[model samples]
Target: MKSISRATIGLTSSVSVLGVVLLAVLVYCCIHFWQAKQQEETANRALHAVEHLLLKPTSEYSPEDVKHGLEEVLGGQGRTQARVVDSRGNRMFGPEVFFNGEGSIREFSQVFETELPQLQAKRVELAVSTVDDERFLNFISGIFASSIVLWILVSVLISMRLIRLVLRPINRLTERIHNLGPRSLDVVLDDHKAPLELRPFIDGFNRLLGQLRENREQLKLFNSNVAHELNTPLSSLTISHELLQRRKLIEGEDLQKIVGDHLDELDRMARIIRSMLFLANANQGRKLQLQPVPSLRQLVVSVAEYLEQLAEDRDLRITVKSDATVEAETELIKRAVSNLLSNAIRYAQANTEITVHITLEAERVWIKVSNEGPTIDPLKLNRLFEPFFRAEEGRSDTGSNHGLGLAIVAAIAKLHGGDVFASSENQVTVIGFSIQTKRQSASG
Candidate 1:
């Protein structure tokens, strides 16, 4: 029932994209700063070289000549416009220069008659660097603005892709849930198409829902069947008691027979109840922890003795043939073999032979119980093991079986990692079970 919000996914994707953009901008800033540092070093070195070349002292130069040479170098290199000034703060050599704009202008007494040396420095100015253009700054800002626009576009694109990737499966699950009623137990999720990280969660949810749905159906069926089975016996007992009450001669052999019939009905009810409880436990996934089982030959021999009287009554033969031991719980295997034998006896002809054989071959133990009965209809063979599935109405009339015996057998076999098969040939039918053999050791 847990779910993630749409806003959370969108916010997470946006943050991830913003992190990537910030990293890209960090790299750009580092490159820009490095290039600016290298340009500053180059410009300083070029200015120093120009100054050293122009001011080198030579024996043939006067002070005036040296000043003129420096000024010529400045003009050639387009360094600043230069000029020499006299004590009167007036230009004495070079082209005239002007200070067109002034900041904090000083009040002067009519053009200096003999100015201070610092004031005369105004005439010796070098290259005045060009004022940076406002238009060029605007162009650089435009580039940054475009980059911001692209970042927003790219982040939107990335968030959209992530939403599609994440929400598609969840949307499918939601649609499936909406379609679901009490009967979506058969719905199977496509694991191959599901995200690997979500596969386990999806699979687990499907399994839990399937189990609950199955349990509901099973409970309904169990109640209906239990009521039907018990009602017949109870009705018979009530009728028999009413007849005895209405009759005068109640202390005779006939009366005892009537009571015996009532007891038999009660016994049938008890058997059905016990089988239902076991099935309920099995369906709820109770475990039967196992250890090494007894020898197959011994188990078969025991079951034959246990069912000997029933076989004798029906004039049937019980046989066991085993070459090796089986690894199975003694009680569970006995129950399974007994169910097979009972099922065979129910269908077998009177005075016919019934053979129960146990054999060990090819690292497996197979126990087969076959009877000389009419061949079972091919279509109904596979369904024989399902709960409450009787072969036909005629076969179940006298025995009055509740029809859970073979189901119990099948459940037991699955618990032990084995199976039962029923196959018919030449007017005879065989039902059998096989289990894996313990592997041999190298020392053996």
Candidate 2:
């Protein structure tokens, strides 16, 4: 990438060039105006000299007198010549020189009528050459050109310094980012000291760092939980294998039962692994292939039916209410509902009803499962959907429930562009999720 300093310098140079062009035009105009003013003043002086000569007595109005009078008024400069002419256009006074100057010549004439007929209709003419004015203007232009060159050089130097000053903070930020390691994830840029223009960027980057730090901590906790969960079943299987190896004296039926228990443990391990994989995919933002669910009520009903035996064990009745049509991954939705129903059945009070309520509002479908169970602590309620985070009451059932069920439900909800929520109050616990319906997705 090109340096920002270079780009800024180029821009400043362009502005400088534009300013110089405008300044040059202004100088040229001023020089031209000065030249015109000087010529006008000189012509006025010659006119005044001619008027004085006319005021003299006609007897004293000899050509020599007229010439001397004009010369005295006009300074007899070689560049400026004056002559007096009669009505017949014959030169009668002043120099007889015709201009042969190096520059353009300008002539001024004033015809006067005198009271003496002898001097009647005399024309006074002054010719001025622009050679001296041109030389002076040239000299002034040279100085201005030199000044403009110096100004450009100084401006370039100042611009470079300013660019460096402006970019110092950004360079420092880049270096700081470059030096960051996993251990330094908590470090943040100080926006307070940053330039106003860069504060927003610094603040946003600091926020991203904050998120990364949070995710890193979560990943560490997740890894530890996964190891602890898998270790239980592995330990059980290991102990069973070791017992079988040492006790060949055990009967066939006992041996088969032991093998079956091992299989169950293996199955539990498989479920945990599968749940972890699903959570990983979800966190990675894997896209879901969505299909239209004809009725949300039917879906909940089907999940309830599948877990009917589990509900029956607790003497809990499963009741589903309302319906909504939504766009979602059908199997994932079913899995999420199954997890919610199973969780409700596990915790619900015996002989109490577990209600599955579906609500449709503003193009969103909410499916809430409420069970008559012990109220969950508000503090723990928010974390109920986190992986491996089972409530105290459910921890004893870790052999069958590794606590990934609710987390899976949360992931599925997120896959459908929704979220999971939980609340426990008034001896009734409710766990639910909301999904965007087909109409909502289409509109969005």
Candidate 3:
């Protein structure tokens, strides 16, 4: 047999169920109708045989002989009820027949009356009735039960087989697609055996992936070109700043002031470039590529030691504590710590304390920088880590700040799978960061 698909199975199963149900009802009706017809025909034959036999009988034989012949003719197949009576209505023979309705003895004798008018005859009759109807009732119940069980079994088998067949092509297609990697971006998802309805959806997904690949290539090229172009101008600016510092256009105090101003500007530019590089490296998943370096304690100490003068210059005191190991790119980690220190030193009240802590917690390292400063707007805090985002843009020219410092700090932290947080209340503002530790085997 050809295998039926799910749709056809459903149709076939439904049709079979309907046919069986109808057939059962038809068979029951047919049996009742056929048996009734057969009983009537048998009764007619017996009446004819009895009239012919009885007419010869009473003259040549005894009444007992006629009765015995009639009884023998109508024996069991199904129960048969009968009666025989004389023209005056006296009972002649047969087992007792329950008198039902207004049935008359003359009407019953009419069986042979049509064939033998005015002839002496014995009236004969037969009727089919439900003596015990429970057999038919049991038959109907069994048919219903069997039908229900068969319907469930067949439906389950059909649905299961259909579900498996439908999913087979899809499962195969999924495996083929998953086994393909970035190396097979050019390859198409197999449409062979793919359902007609699903092909369009699959095609759309593949087209989307193709577009994403093209966009990524364009972005990579653009990033490279922009970095190169910007570096050229930065180099020229560096050389000009150096040559100007060497010139004697203005002497002593004036020369020192000009160089300081130019140095700050140069520092700002350098920071922007460094921030870009850190962000680029961070997102590219370069965490494992960073060299393992001194513990968090040493990194903090180094930054504090360098920024100690700037702290003192601003009448601020600095303190460092703790010893904890961490894995990170040294230069970037130092830059991040220094930015936090510089930000603290810049914003702290003129003669207050700046506290720096290096903490070792289970599985990681943390750096905390705290200072007494005015509270920052919480709304501004969220965007504080975005590139070139300056909250103090409203500040006077003399008090202006290059806002890329905190952004670069965040970038460097992320490059090492770390993060920075800021919190402030009253006169205290805290800046903190955490980093994961890398342990070395004692033998290494």
Candidate 4:
């Protein structure tokens, strides 16, 4: 579909409104001018007729003859009337006229004295009425209609030209965007040459381009990591199967051990795939099966119990201090809590207590796991929740720690309308997140 520029739309609408206003003003002025012109012309005709009659020699025309001439000129038009009075204010000619009706009347009068060689000087007062405006109104309407048509034509042409001038740079910018791609991150919009109004938008688009490029690089690295992780287990399984095929006569405990080894490798691959699928779902913004849980403490206790053996193996004790209830998806919340507990068991110092502290607020609940360990670097802490980003200061068991636990926790927290946080100081580290309750979720 074809699109119109904002400048075009704005100018077109503005010009249309201005044209309407101009047309109204011009029509009113034309109507008034036409009415005034018609009245002045009629009055001048009456005055000229009186002057001509008065200038005639008294021998040539009498007062009655001049009066008759005045009647012929003014009385012919039904809307106009004329009268002549002498210097004594007595009626000399024409009928007495007065405004005695409901509608408005237009009247003009003049008084003058005339001298003749063979007659006594006589004064005359002349009056005329010329109030009918039908022809004048029709003329004004024609002129006004023509003026409006001309205005519309001129305004449309001028508006089109002005809009083109205004949108030239924007058109260039659009073309530039259309030509851009992942490989074109180095391209930059020239803000100096662009219009002042579009500078901020250009700068913002550049920032977005930079971010997109960075994400693309991260995605490439993530894919490589995933391939390598899967490749290792597949290679091990391939070697085991090959060994079994070569030694078909072999049996007993050695074969059983080989099968168990394959199972372990398969389990590792399965875990990685499951974690990736969960993260993919989270990124897609899928809605959760949110519900109210009876007790946040109970949820933590269950996760702690599931990881009790792992903590005991590391000579660590698990402790829960929660007294709040929260609303969240049952299975997803359990998964998040289990990931946090397992992460704590991996890194907490031997014989140290890993404490699960749950804090309830008016609208949300916070579940924190704190453990005494080698202080994590403040700089590295920012990336602790990034997928596959395991800190050097934390657990280093590559076989069991796939570096996705904390990432999963972060995703679950985000899905529950919350975020993850981490801090380490004084030989202690804390890692946890908050989840808004059902009330907060519903309101949001």
Among the numbered candidates, top lDDT falls to 2
Q: Tens-digit lDDT track for model 4 on 1-444?
A: 445765565668577858676867777777778777877787777777776777776778776775566567545245555666665576655666533332445666765666553323254333334334655566667776786677777777777788888889999999999999878877887899998999999999999988888888879878977887788889999998898889877679997899898899999999999999999999999798878787777778888888888888888988887467667898988888888888777777899999988876667678899999888888889989988888874435767778788999999999988888799999899999889765432111
Flag regions of model 1 displaced more than 4 Å. 1-16, 19-27, 30-34, 37-176, 183-224, 350-353, 357-365, 395-397, 434-444
Where is model 4 more than 4 Å wrong at Cα?
6-147, 393-396, 438-444
Candidate 1 per-residue C-alpha lDDT over 1-444 given as tens digits, one digit per residue, 9 for 90 to 100: 434545655576578657756766775666556644554554455445434433444545555555655565445233233344555577654455323332221111112221232223233323332323233345555666687668767766776777787888888877876887766667766677877877897888888887887778867876776787888788898898788778878777887898889889999888888887877787676677555654566676787788889888888877765445555666887888888888887788888888877665576666788988788788888877777777775535633577888888877776666677789878899888766658311110
Report the alpha-carbon TM-score of model 2 versus the true structure: 0.81
RMSD in order of candidates = 9.5, 4.5, 16.0, 7.7
Q: What does candidate 4 score in Cα RMSD to the true structure?
A: 7.7
Whole-structure CA lDDT of model 4: 0.77
In candidate 2, clashing pairs total 0
- How many backbone overlaps does candidate 1 show? 3
Alpha-carbon lDDT of model 3: 0.67
C-alpha local distance difference test of each model: 0.66, 0.83, 0.67, 0.77
Q: Residue 230 in model 2: shift from native, Å? A: 1.2
TM-score of each: 0.67, 0.81, 0.43, 0.76
Question: Model 3, range 375-440, lDDT digits (tens) per residue?
Answer: 888887776676545555553332234456787777767666678888878979888787766652
Per residue, candidate 2 scores C-alpha lDDT tens digits across 1-444 of 987789999889779867986888798889889898889888777777777777677676775565566567655467677777878988776666646444677888997866665554378888888878888888878887887888788888989999999899999999999999999998878888888999999888999999999889878988999999999899999999899889778887997899899999999999998888889899899898988887778888988998999899889899988777788898999999999998998888999999988876676788899999898899889889888888875459888789999999999888887888899999999999989765532111
Q: Scored by Cα lDDT, where does model 1 land?
A: 0.66
The deviation in Å at residue 106 for candidate 1 is 33
Candidate 1 pairs with clashing backbones: 80-126, 80-127, 321-358
